[model samples]
Target: MPSNDSLARASGNVKWWKNANIFQIWPASYKDSNGDGIGDIQGIISTLDYIKALGVNTIWISPMYDSPQIDMGYDISDYESVYPPYGTLDDMDQLIKGCHDRGMKLLLDLVINHTSDQHKWFQESRSSKTNPKRDWYIWRPAKYDADGNRQPPNNWMSCFSECAWTWDEHTQEYYLHLFCVEQPDLNWTNEECRREIYRSAMEFWLEKGVDGFRVDTVNMYSKPMDFPDAPIVDPLSKYQPAGTLYCNGPEMHKYLREMAAILARYDAMTVGELPLTPNTKDVLDYVSLKDPQLSMVFQFDLVDIGRGPVDMMKLTGYKLSALKAIINKWQTFIEGNDGWTTVFSENHDQGRSVSRFASDAPEHATNSAKLLAMLNTTLTGTMFIYQGQEIGMTNVPKDWPIEEYLDVGSINYMKLIKEKLEATGASEEEKAKAVHEALLNINAVGRDNARTPVQWDSSPHAGFTTGKPWMRVNDNYKKINAAAQINDPDSVLSFWKRMIGLRTKHSSLFTFGSFHLLEPENEQTFSYVKKSAEGDEKALVVLNFTDQAQEFKLPTEDGANWSLLQGTQPVEDPTSAPLKAYEGRVFVNFGARD
Candidate 1:
């Protein structure tokens, strides 16, 4: 629960953001009000009521800026302007105000590690060695190894695969980009670049009343002078090792401190995306509770936990012990510390939580929604809701053609899976599995799955647009959409509302309370308890991971009067209570069933 002191930071009774459960919106797929087939700010405004009804208090939008679209909107050309594909600057202003009017905060996507080649600085730097902006980008002569032939600066590889350094004919050297060839990483070594970026673009959003930022690739600011080579892992990981040197350099904290100092000046809420750092242990030092350098950090451990060889139908059954261990690893890191964790199973980059955790079948999807929500909502961390997640979106169809595919990571994995399938000695069934693996790699948790337009109604393009949508809407829009659920008491949206309301009413016990793991031995279920500073213990989170009903044995001291809070089924006595497969049980010490 929020303390009287932290809650006191409110401005004139502004105690809103503290209990806010945020949702992430990828603009391209939300809704297109102008009928141009692209979801715009106007379309989002039209759906505000739908979102507000989901018990959401904060919205985090992905990048929607002036861009070359080389890597989507991440390769930004202009910093402060809204892209025409989305809307005008006025549209964004109204969107922010619309959110605030409904008691919600909007956070912008801050992608600063690299800029589009069209950025003025990159343009000037590429012009010539004598250009004023030459130092703004890292440029160096090609190095020759004992093997012979000019190589990229160090053995550094790009995060997007291949070499991180791109040879520029004009400069007669290489420029670095941790992603695509068109996005050259900025040289943070230059003080001018840092100040101008923060003063102009970074600080501009906050000044515009934007609540906070989801800092994209913020930790890849400083790189080692000697970019070293990484030991090869996958046979297909031909990518260079830019991370060996570019990620988490010695000055990482210094730069983050500088950013924290600058953003602190404006009191902005900043969360970082650390691709290289998945475990909470990796970022524990700066992001603890007492001294949070970042408001929270997105650790992709659970998101990437299913990864390995892509066997389509094969499940990496996380025996309950391992799952508890993973959760315990994170819980203990935050045990005596102040840094909090951000919880979410699905996001723009990953497959839907329902499809990934539970079965993708509709029945399973429904259970996963309630089950996962019960688990994460009670953990000692901040909860984030991805758009359409509350309604229980599933992964893309396996039959989606190659043409429908997007996302570089999926593409890399698909190519590898296909090559393995083509190995001549494989049997027909084996070949089919290989192909299935390719589809899984492409659709398992691929971006395109989440990029599908939000299912708003049964109308054309799922009522996302009157015009042709930029991306195709799911065919199941008729059966699943916001329109049908908005007023339906039994709709998934309605259940989500209840879930959030329960959390809000019990914020003190859920938000700041320390987490304690229970029943670590059971593979089919997870149980945990949380207690706050005042010893106001009311939070008890339990989840069922399997399809069959399972018994939960709670620790002795925690055996208190309990009542069901949220679940597909109801909670009975844990000792004899058998929860249906994938069903969840959230309970409070209400002196009912125990």
Candidate 2:
């Protein structure tokens, strides 16, 4: 159902990713074949059949390159080598072959924004100010305070709640690290640095036969030339939010174009993790067909709906209207401009879709999961299914203590909370209460919620690993594991299969069709219509987002011959009866539009 004009523009340039359903695998928690309490390439190769059976045609594995695991593989020390814990180069080859043999494409996670501090490039860059590789990373001389004490070059804050600049006494300078101090930001402004990245990160993987790359922190490759302090948003905090100064800097598009030119040689898929840049027009600069850069981008607006401005841990209730506006804006603007975007509700860094966007309560969990599946597949974009989302994984248990959390972000945020409470001189009882509330909020919104090991079966370790898992399996795995639902007709797993199959069977209507939101202000229901390019095929999707039944009216003008294609709950007449809690339905109209 792609428009003739759009098709003409992409003639002889059609990409396989246009219709692909990508499944993301966070390798560490996916499965373990070595019994070493960690997942590896062999474990992923073992599960290729299971992933393909879910109707996904592409698999995007998080970083498996040689790393220190400070940020769980995001901090790459060696771009050309596989981590010893994961496997050797031969194991990675088998994973690529395993995916190719199943007719599935593989995308390796690319972390070029920064590298592990232990990387050889950084090691030499920091050895001395006169080293040949000294300029490979950002380094600035220290500044003096009013008390004549040495301080960092700027007041920029790290994403992990610390000063962005780290002092290096050996070089007599401070270096930049936007994340953990163990991960240093590379100097993309250096032409030699950029050349090396293209050679090692892109060309090396393309030679390995990967289908494409998923660039992490893609928009942050460039930083402002002038070191500047961000306006103080948190008076009590010493450092300030500096993402605006670094994200989508002046030279970002130039770097992307250079990277894209190289990727074009292999005709590879390129999806970038574009954080902090939310405007659709700004996003189009990177993904628009007029001036192509990335194949698509993962915009954070939808996931960041209820997060606080300064601290993501400060949680609040999200309104359905806000969610609807974000979806409508991205879906319409991106597609309308001949740009592309990924449709996803969950990922490695987010809480489970069912727990975050829908109800995860026992009474509504299954139905709500199906409802979310319907919404994701019906939208006009490539779909990405995070691991464990297909079987309705929820957040970590509420009773879990703070010590069990493993994510650096979660741990850092909690540490900051404890320090703040102490600074206020709160009593021990008051401190305990404040800490407990913070832990509850982290349980609800932390990255560790999705980092729990996958529940393959109801075994001691949920069948994820024979040895103890690096992370704990959710306690509810006994009732919710994939093994329990693989064969059940009404299980979340089966429902996901059906939903994916429906999207595939009608790819034109689901992928390239025109989207029209229905009842935009409705608080209890989300409904939309997708019309094929020829106007002969149309699909109407209706979803109830609340815990109570809600009445909805079908559009009289769109006609009365609509037939129910699928539903989360059985319904004889969808329009006549009120929708049950968390219910969803899809109706198809095959007649030509007037």
Candidate 3:
């Protein structure tokens, strides 16, 4: 019964990780080399020819392991070294031999469900409770309170909050740390802690040739095998942190089919960020090429759709029919189930899809970052591209003070919204105007807006450092850099190299196409149309998501016989073209389709 029709049944084997685009790279705000102000791995092997001139073939990065950067390198400690201010292990073996001599494909960033309580196997599993690395991590034993106090082995919590247990006091016990008590959590039902987390951190980078793994926090690595308690639903929301009693648990697909039988003896590429909720049967049990445990799975339900609540301060107006009904409900359930997905809208923990879903209005931020790179390179999947999103990066300047925030989940969610506005006894001038309007709704969903830097030009640190820049560079890097939009042929990094050269000149119209969400209750227009499952290729797209002028129609009932092919704002007479505001075109039907 598992059928969305199985994402257009494609087991015909099409790897290079199914037409990847990737990119991510937070490595200390990408590019600093030796000046010590962070960023290394020889500043991403000297920007691998500016990420192979942005046609992006895959470069994930992000963790740069051996950490103690607390939460920055996601507190790893040492999964086989390399985080001395981001370089070593022969600068990650020359960044996997300079991204396989440029035809790129590096990945890495696989944070193994946790470690780094200064990990020496969590300091000999908190040294004591019979330390033969005492159960490798996740401890327990506190729950007292029969008015005798000492209570925390249950009501979980810490997703950077106040309590996902912690105690220890010399192994009297209470460990678990669902994020940031310097990380901890591991014990994956200890099959020798899942074979030393897949042989000391994923077979030491797939035996050094590194071409996969973005898996950090891949559904919080299996839980619920007993450690219960989280079911108070909402008794006035107190300690409400069950996240389905430990996110996507139940032996998460039997420990992702034991790391997909060691990533099927290495033809790699894994993806998996998956904070969840974009369900197509748990994303076809992790990108099913008939049970293949992940080659795709970012899906955070369109970045938690219109993020609101948490001492709110406005910023949730969505409706382009709620982002085309959550991107056509995960593009019609991963195009009928054979599943694979990742089309990302900003990453390094989001907030800069041209400033959260388009339009940073400096005359519509490079036409809304070229209509979010023509809706993530004419959708279908494997797109990613986060590092300073092409060239139109935005956000991080709505009055920068919360101590110039360096995200530990946006500084513990602005000190838990200034301790719930000083417990509503308000007025310290209304709790400093509700924490400066919740730090302008946490600077519109922050993750330091994709951790700043990588502007690469407008110098003085925008060229990403000769020193002094572990963060904070987005002073619109002299009108967005990359040496001023790398030879601007109508920039936004040349409409992301002309939508990655029309996804390599219509690669099966964005791969095995048949997605159709056109005007699915279009409120501010987002249209769609792919086709090509042998119905002789087609395209379509549209867009606009508001700024004003809207009137569109062209699902081609004779829209002057479709043609345009790529646009930001060019209607020019498709039977009375209107679109404009954040316009994005695309069209293509050389005829056929009644």
Candidate 4:
């Protein structure tokens, strides 16, 4: 457990993730408890000890709520109910109780941006415009283009693909679904909707002693009221509409403050999955403790490796200066501010960290992965570690076709490919390659990479389940698995154990210390120093984002030699002694130049 003093020391200011390291568990693939071939609360309960052993103080589970499962539970039919397939409410209760018993905290997914179309609330809203619940969703009267053709109310594009509007014959209007048609966006403008969603949903779990919430699609709550047609970016963009009109609306801060007030009653940790580019500071300002909209916001810009928007060709490219600038801004923003930040390289939505950020080559992959872990763990912010990250998982197989693609973003991109091909009169092969590359950009590094069943052993299912899993497990399980790495001191899993243990051990140095970026100009190699009032600490975070090892000079304090803190490929060889490919080193600054 982390020391109380360290937590308190780090608390007066908002940046909680700084002293904390959280492990994310994607339930469906973690471990199945009931021979039901799916993971449940019982499965999570079984792994509590294992998670505790890893030294992580918190666990953030993906959604396991009642849902159509159309979008893997993102389309929640019941915000307060647990999915029967995953487990009963009792199971969640027991798990929460058990987590508390083991001194671990639990964070549930907060998917309030939209609700499943099948939800009772949606059913009521869609029944008739005159119904009491009709105002619960964002439904608008249909408008006609110059051609007099019936069209959606606005040019709102779904994050999954094109337009966010879904035509409903009964209502004679389109309901908004920022992601999927099945997941209709709720109407925050409705007072009842806002109160019910926040108070009821929050109180449900807070009553059960859940400690925090991980908000989903947080920035999509507010939309433009104009409901006007959007200018065409792509004739197909007619589908998504002008998202800017609805995204980060002027009243978003107002709604957030309302929700924050309720969350504060229970002192629940609030983390928003804020997707923003220019509004980084503005977003933080809304959620900082001073305003209390939330406790923290996740930082994904570092992991959003695509050069612009979602381009695959630049996925492997490194912009050290850009990456440094991003982190530096975040560090400065939350340093003395009222809010905090959560650190991560990969998650259920991202490709495996080693595969996406690090080279897949065995010699360098795991090292690169570890270097990523070191950078976050030492930086002045909280950290989130995804499942299988500890063991260095890679992206999924590329053989999966459109039929196998389950993620909406991937499928939508597939549609876009076909459209582009037809519009440009390209060959079938060209179209397929374009779609595949786009898929590679979105889900290729591996949509299912993090979704692969947990590798617990060399046996079948890697000890994840006794029966077939909903998703396929990685083929490399035979060689790279929990059983094989648990005892290996040099294994990635062991290194993570070290990373977590150190944070808990040196909370004073790791959590409450001041953070400063060493270089803001260099783009490839990231270096920073974490300073404290009593003493200064430095860590040279050198990473080879490229495929090969490159020689470079890094500043080191005289007598403050660098040591391999946690990394893959050993940095012991003479030529690579100073730096290892995909490796990260933490050096203690002893003062004076080398």
Better model by lDDT: candidate 2 vs candidate 3? 2
Model 2: residues >4 Å from true position, as ranges? Answer: 1-13
Candidate 3, residue 113: the lDDT equals: 88
RMSD, one per candidate, in order = 3.9, 1.6, 22.8, 3.7
Please tell me which predicted candidate would have the highest TM-score against the true structure. 2
What local lDDT score does residue 28 receive in model 4, on the 0 to 100 scale? 85
- Predicted structure with the largest lDDT when compared to the true one: 2
lDDT of 3 by residue, 196-312 (tens): 889888887799888778887788788875678887653433454666678888787788888878877888889887774455786677788787777777777677677753322
229-317: candidate 1 lDDT, tens digit per residue: 66565444445344545667787777777787777777677778876665566587557534545777777667766564323223454
For all candidates in order, the CA lDDT equals 0.73, 0.88, 0.77, 0.72
Q: Candidate 3: give the clashing pairs.
A: 4-336, 6-336, 6-338, 7-335, 7-336, 7-337, 7-338
Alpha-carbon error at 363 in model 3, in Å?
A: 2.0
Worst ten-residue run, lDDT, model 1? 6-15
Kindly provide the TM-score of model 2 when superposed on the true structure, using C-alpha atoms: 0.97
lDDT of 4 by residue, 124-144 (tens): 999998999998898887889
Q: What residue runs in model 1 are displaced by over 4 Å at the alpha carbon?
A: 1-18, 145-148, 235-244, 278-282, 289-292, 309-317, 415-435, 552-559, 570-576, 590-594
Query: What TM-score would every model get versus the actual structure?
Result: 0.90, 0.97, 0.34, 0.91
Model 3 alpha-carbon miss at residue 185, Å: 6.9
Q: Tens digit of lDDT per residue, candidate 2, span 53-170?
A: 9999999999999999999999999999999988999999998998999999999998998999999999999999999889989999999999999999889999999999999989
Give the Cα error of residue 391 in candidate 4, in Å: 1.4
Model 3 quality (TM-score): 0.34
